[model samples]
Target: MVLYGLKNCDTCRKALKLLPEAQFQDVRADGVPGDVLKSAYEVFGAQLLNTRSTTWRGLSDAERALDPLDLLAAHPTVMKRPLVDHDGQLYLGWNSDVQAALLG
Candidate 1:
């Protein structure tokens, strides 16, 4: 399983702290592999992109319209933080609901 995000990302840090045993791959540092990137897009589709993040908001309108797959493939930062992959399933972000689901 892989958790994708920047090591310093607050949500990522919190999620990691919550699941200390879980393996993580900081996308900013490790960089997602082609197969992983493709899997993320296939699993989560546009939801993988964090359109609400400051990173996404900072992008120009033109940059925003580029296909999410392309953006994710080209610049990993465009993808949402705290992506979790477990048992071949992918999830985006770490929210209360996600934590509850994981805990359940």
Candidate 2:
């Protein structure tokens, strides 16, 4: 199991706190690898990006025009928080329903 997200993000923090036993790869300190981001994009499509994040809203019009792959490659921070990969399944954000399914 691999969780990809920043350390400071609240939702990410919640996910980590909720599942203390889960393994995580902190993207803020460790930096999200290109291949990992690419796989995330493929798995979640635009859903991978958290539109509600300040990072997403702060992007310039030109930045928003970039494709999914380019967007992730350029600014991984814009990607959704608490993106979890358990085995091969992917979950975007931390929803209770999703949590229930994954934790089981």
For residues 17-87, write the lDDT of model 2, one tens digit per residue: 87787788876667677777777778778788778878889999999988877876677788777878777
Give per-residue CA lDDT, model 1, range 22-69, as digits (tens). Answer: 798978777777787788788777788877777788888888888877
Q: For model 1, where is the 10-residue window of minimal lDDT? A: 67-76
Each candidate: RMSD: 1.8, 1.7
Cα lDDT for residue 22, candidate 2? 77
Q: Local error of candidate 1 at 103, Å?
A: 2.6
lDDT of 1: 0.80
Q: Give the top-scoring candidate (TM-score).
A: 2
TM-score of each: 0.82, 0.84
Q: List pairs with backbone clashes in candidate 2.
A: none
Q: Deviation in angstroms for 1 in model 1? A: 2.6
